[model samples]
Each structure stands twice: as structure tokens, then as C-alpha cells.
Target: MNFFLETLRFIGLCLYYTLEYIFLLFIPVRKKNVAGEIVLITGSGSGIGRLMALKFARLGATLVLWDINGEGNKETARLARKIGAIRVHNYACDCSKRQEIYRVADQVKKEVGDVSILINNAGIVTGNRFLEAPDLLIEKTVEVNTMSNFWTVKAFLPAMLAANHGHLVTIASMAGLVGSNGLADYCASKFGAVGFAESLMLEMAVQGKTGVKTTIVCPYFINTGMFDGCKTKWPSLLPVLEPEYVAERIVSGVLRNDIYILMPRSLYFLYALKSIFSTKAFIPAAEYLGLFTVMDTFRGHTKKAEDKHQKTGTKTPRSLN
Candidate 1:
């Protein structure tokens, strides 16, 4: 009886906090207008990056689109211009390459004006088991997902600090908040991204640079071609996010200068539970409860699609099955 009461009390407290968080999230706050602002978005070729670029363009911001795929970059630029961006600049550069990032940053500064917003949205996944993942794949994953943030920030933040105003947004993943099988490299990169954003925020706070806001977006599986074939078992607990929905939230968060934006919000509670509960207790329980299988199935399906894509030189559209 005592144990049951204590558990209920804990649940009640968590619920209280959850509701408080949602209320705060939905509450109207002053937003900085993006009109005439210069925004840089990596991986703007497609998926969430492209969606975000479109949103900013609709708000009348000048856009600088960066991606490794030249054709995709051009297409994003065309789309942004069509959507009413004041100006759209496209650059083809591998974000994982520090030198390439430096070059692009210099070019943007000269051609486009100081960037008022920086979105580090470029990321890649190997979709292979830990042992099967080659060393090169692991390195590339870390370089693109983790190191690229550092390079981009270092390249653009100096100007923002000097100007005393800018928004830095990092699009991390829910996987960073929780461990998953067959995603060791991807998870490690995302976890590093979360840590990097948190540490940067703390540094800014300590330095009293409050005007320079940082927002970290940690979202669940998004229905983008990047995660095609991924599946989730708990639709209620972890429904797959739509790219447009995630983009809207991201833009809203940046406008409001929010520090940590966790989509769905409920995942924060699950993260807390994971931390508070013993691994031995929660891991087995989560597995038996069918939670672990969600990401595992996703990984398996993604791996199969990637294999098929490599075997045949044809790309498959995003599909849950």
C-alpha cells in the first residue's frame, strides 16, 4: 500500500510538471520578426531543412541554402525565391568539411550580409549495427552530425557576438535523449549535439550574453525521406512527427527565443523516468512493454532500404512499411 501510494504521488508530480511545461510552451510570447533578417540553414536541400527554409522565406527573410547536393541546393533556392524570400543564395559544400564551411561562411558574409539566424540541421545516419559499421562510417557520422555544428557556430557566432544579437538553432533528435539499438553511431553524434548545445547555452548565460539566444530542437521520427522505412510501435506515446509540424514549431521557438524545444513535450517525462529508474529495471521493463522494439524495427527496415538502394541505383520514396 505504501509503495502504491508513493508511485501514485510520483506520477502525480510528473503530470503536474508536464502540464506546466505544455502551458508554458503554448503561452504567447513576444516574437522577433524575420522580415529582412538573414538566415543560414544547412541541409536546406530537402526534408526538415527545406521546410524550415520555406517557413523563413514566407516570413520575408533572406535565405542562404547550404548542402552537398548542388542540384538540391539550387532547387531549395528556387523554392525559397518562389515562396517570397527577399533573396536566396545557394552554396554546394560538404558541411562535414571544416574548410568548406569556412569558405562558405566567408562567401555568405561578403555576398549576403551578417546572418541573424543559423540553423544547424544537417545530419546523417549509418543505419548499420555497431559491429557492422565501418570506422569511416562512424567518423563521417560524428563529423557531419556533431563536428559540423562546431564549425558552423565558430564560423558565424563571432559576428553574432559582436553584433550582440542572433539565434542559433540546433536540430537534434529524440534518440539523443534515449539509447536505442542499431543506432550507436547516430545516437552518439546526436548526444554530442545535445551536450554541445547545452554547454553553449550555459556559457552564454555565464557570460551574460542573454541577447544571443540558442534553441535546441529534439524531436521524434520525422516523416522525411531521411528516415524512410522507420517504424514506431507506440503511436500514442511516440507518434511519428510530420516535417511541416516540426518546422513550424522550430520557427516558432526561434522567434520566441526558446532555449530548449522538445516536440510532443511528453518525451521529457520519459527521459526523466529513464534517468530515475535503474537500467536493469527499466531496460527489461521497456523491452517487455514493447518500447525497445519500436526503434529496432525502424533500424532494420532502414538498413534494408539502404541496402536495396545501393544494390540498385534507384532511390525509394519514404514509406512506413
Candidate 2:
């Protein structure tokens, strides 16, 4: 009798949540206020990380920015403060190092406060055919893109869980949801991030910490120098996104407490198709979409920067973030 009763309750709750999701699709999600909230952003030196810091700063959130490059991190800090961020803290910590992440996280907690918003936005891409890619770059990619998430979550999730209120955001990639050529390591890392975020969401739910929110953002190639020489085969279908637009979408998704935020909206359909279609069907679709040859001309951030520097005979920043 108890089993039957519990099953009925579960079914009813499922229907309720399903209807609520549909309702939310038509109505605008209420944007939560982050004023006075402490927000931590990794890879905050450049690309999406730096963009997000500026947006959060404008929104009145205290910013804690971390990057491996001290000068670039300080540059972001200066920009954030200029954007009206009342409290902006900058730390030079290598995300690929477990101890460094923990040490910096501890310092942030002591210097700033508990991080109400944690955005694990640090990522790297080899953009080379798997065999051609350097072994060391592959290892560093995994260390930074996958393991860093674990360390940062460990450092901040406890406080969020204790308060039963906080937001965890992962800046994954469309490569995470769909496999592509020349991005084996990158895809692996992103897939790990997606899985980590999903599992954490389930864990939070099981612990009855409903107030702690998790949002996983999966976006396609953006105009940032990270993917400098890459091209989209289907410009209309999968355009290279603008950094500002991508950054804005991330902030909006976090504000709305969205669980999975896939940019281009069309990606939702593609992901669904992948789940529904067999290998034969998905393979043709993937080919037509040009996923296999997307990285043929890949000259990544540092490479492109170095090329320009050599041509111009001038030095410039070269790190991804």
C-alpha cells in the first residue's frame, strides 16, 4: 500500500513539473537579483570569463576573477571596476593545478566571502587532428577543463549546500553534446563538464537543496580569438557566435536558473535528433552539418596571435585565458 501511494505521488509530481516546464517556455523566467552576491569566475583573463565579469560587475555583484596570467587577470579586474563593480578581486591561479585552485579558492573565501555564483568557464582546445596533437597539450586540456571543475566545486559547493542557496555554472561547448572531428580532447573535457554538472544537479536534488541551482551552458564556436582560424561550414545554421552575445546569454541563463542552456536554440533539436536517431541516420546529419571537417583550417588562439606578432614584429598576449 505504501509503495503504491509513493508511486502515485511520484507520477503526480512528474506531471506537475512537466506542465511547469511548458508554462515557463511561454512566460519569461523571473530574473533573480545578484546584487551584493559574491561571484567567482575562472579563466577570467579573457574571452567569455572576462566578458561575464564585466556583466556581473555592472549588475552589482562582487567579482572574484582568477586566471593563470597575473597581468591579464589584473587587466580584467581594472575593466570590471571601471564597469562599476564595487568589489572586484583578482587572483593569479593556474586552473590546471589542483593545489593552486584550492589555495586561491581559500584566499577568495577569506578575502571576499562565500561565492554565491561559481562559473567554471576555463577551457582549452588543441584544434588539431587527434594524432597530430601534442601529448602534453592533451593532458593539460583535461587537467584544466575537467579536473578544475572538480576542485572548484569542492572548494565552493559546501558553502552553497550549507546555505541551500547558490548557483553553479559550467561553460561547456556544443562539442560536449555532439562529437566532432579534430576536437577529441576538447570534446572529452566538455563532455566531462556536462556530466559533472548534471550529476551535481542530481546530488543537490537528492540532498533536498532545491535552492542551490545548476546551469550548464553549451555554446558553439564564438568570435573570441580562442577559435581564431576555425570556420562554420553552415554559416546560417551554426554561425560563429559573438563573444558579447554569448556572455550576455550566460548571465541571463544564470539569472533564470536554467538547467541546460544550449545556444543557437536549434542545437536543442539537433541534440534531440541525436538521441532519437540511429547511428546511420545521425552520421548523415553530422556530415551534412560539416562537423567532420570543421577544424580543417584550425590555427588556434596562441598560434594565430604568434603569426600576427611575427608578421608585425610586435609582441602581444597569446594565452587562451
Candidate 3:
């Protein structure tokens, strides 16, 4: 009876803390002016990245846009300038390459200023089954999604450490927290990203670097062409998030120096439930409830599309998971 009471107390305490955190997250805090802050964003050419870039730019930040696509990079810069950015610099570089990232870092420091914020947002997904996925695709996915964070952090974190003030934001995914079929490579990469971000946070805490904040964002599918045909069985429960909504949340989270930013907020409780329940019970229950089937259908559709493209002489556009 004592143990049961203690467990109840613990659960109640956790619930109280979670509710408090959610309230704080929903209420935006006014931030100090970022007029002179220099911000670098990877994959700033499109989707959530583009929206984030605009958000920062509107706040009078000096923007540095990086994308492998030169045209998109240029367009982002133009938009940032139009949005009232104090300064805008666009670069076309493959973030997956360490040398390229280093080169860009050097140029950014010289051309712009010491980066006050770094958003490691570049990512790619090949919607192929695990076994059917080519080795190169897997390597590239890991390189772009996971290893790029390592390179970007190494290159830019030194300045932040020296200044004793900075923000590091990593745009991870829901796949990192929960596995899904047809997203083996994507899941692996995002999981690595989450691990890396968590470890970095621990290191920062151990070092007593409170001024330097790190935020890891795990959001579900966005309304971008990347996850073109993806569908959820319970659309009302797990609706597709808008890129603008995600961008707004990310901007607000960073300003608040939040440690973990989970979109839709309800997932925090779901994650806790998963942690407390036994896999034998939870897995079968989730499967019977159609959670597994929803993801399986999404994966199967992508696989079928890939197979069809392979049979025909046409290439399918890449889709984000």
C-alpha cells in the first residue's frame, strides 16, 4: 500500500510538472531584441527552414542562408531582405560534407559576424524499405540528417562558448522518438540526431554552461511537398502540421531556451505512457488500435511508388517522411 501510494504521488508530480511546462510553452515570452544577432540556418531554401528564416529576419536578425540548391538559396536571401533583415548572405554548399561546412563557416564569420544562433535543419529522406534501400541512399541520409549536425556544431559552437551566450536548435523528427515502417533510414538518422542533441545538452549542463542553450525539436509531418502523399489514420488526433505553425513554435521555443520542443504538445504524455507500459502490452494494443497499420500503409504506398518508378524509366521525386 505504501509503494502504491508513492507511485501515485510520483505520477501526480509528473503530471503537474508536465502541465506547468505545457502552459509555459503555450504562453510566449517577450525576448530581448535580436537586432544585431547573426543567425545561420541550414536548408533555409524551403519548407520549415524558409519560414524560420523569415521569422528571424523579421526580428531584425542578420541572416545567413545555406542550401545545396543555389537558386533556392538566392531566393531565400531575397525574401529575407524583403522581410527586413539587416543583412542577408546566401551560400550553396552540401552540408553533409565536412569540408564544405567548414568553408562556409569561415566565410560566414568573415562576411557576416560570429553566429549567435545556429539551426541545424538540413535533412533528406528516401522513402524506400530497409532491405530495398541502396547503401548509398542510407549513407547519404545519415550524413545529411545526422552527421551534418556534428560538423555544424563543431564549426560554430566555439564562438558561442567564447561569448558565453548562444542558441543551438536541431530540427529532428517524431520518427526519432517513435519508429515507423518505410522510414528505417530516416528513423535511424533522426534517432542519431536526438541522441546527439541530448548528449550535447548533458555536456553543457555538466560544464555549467547555462548561458548557452540547446533545443531539440521533434515534430510530426509538415504540410510540405517532402511528405507529399503521407496519411495518418486518425487525422484529427495526429493532424499534419503546417510549416508556418512549426516555424512559429520553433521561434518561440528558442526564445524561451526550451530544452525539448515536441509539437502538438500531447505527445509528451504519450511518450510518458510508452515509457511506463510494457512493450508486450503496449505494442499489441497500439497495433490493434490501428497505429501500426496507419504507418504501414504510408510506408507501403511509398514502396509501391518506388517500385513503379524503377519498373518504368522515370524517376520519382523524393518524398519526406
Clashes of each: 0, 0, 1
lDDT score for candidate 3 against the true structure: 0.83
Q: List ranges where model 1 is wrong by over 4 Å.
A: 1-27, 285-291, 295-321
**How accurate locally is residue 205 in candidate 3, as Cα lDDT from 0 to 100?**
85
Across residues 7-75, which tens digit of lDDT does each residue of candidate 2 receive?
999999999999999999899988999999999999999988999999999999999999997898999
TM-score of every model versus the real structure: 0.86, 0.92, 0.85
> 1-321, model 3: which lDDT tens digit per residue?
699999999999999988987787687666656667888999998889999999999888888899987898888888888767758889998998999999989998888889989999988877667898777779988999999999999999988888888888999998888777778899999999999999998888898888789999999888766776677656666778998899999997887777888876766776677788887777774664345654443533345567788888677644332
State the weakest 10-residue window (summed lDDT) of model 3: 293-302
| Superior by lDDT: candidate 1 or candidate 2 | 2
After TM-score superposition, what is the CA distance of residue 133 in candidate 3 from its true location, in Å? Answer: 0.8
Using lDDT, give the best candidate's number. 2
Kindly report which residue stretches of model 3 are placed more than 4 angstroms away from their true locations once superposed: 1-28, 285-321
RMSD (Å) per prediction:
6.8, 2.7, 5.0
- Residue 176 lDDT in model 1? 78
RMSD of 1: 6.8
Which run of 10 residues does model 2 get worst, by summed lDDT?
A: 312-321
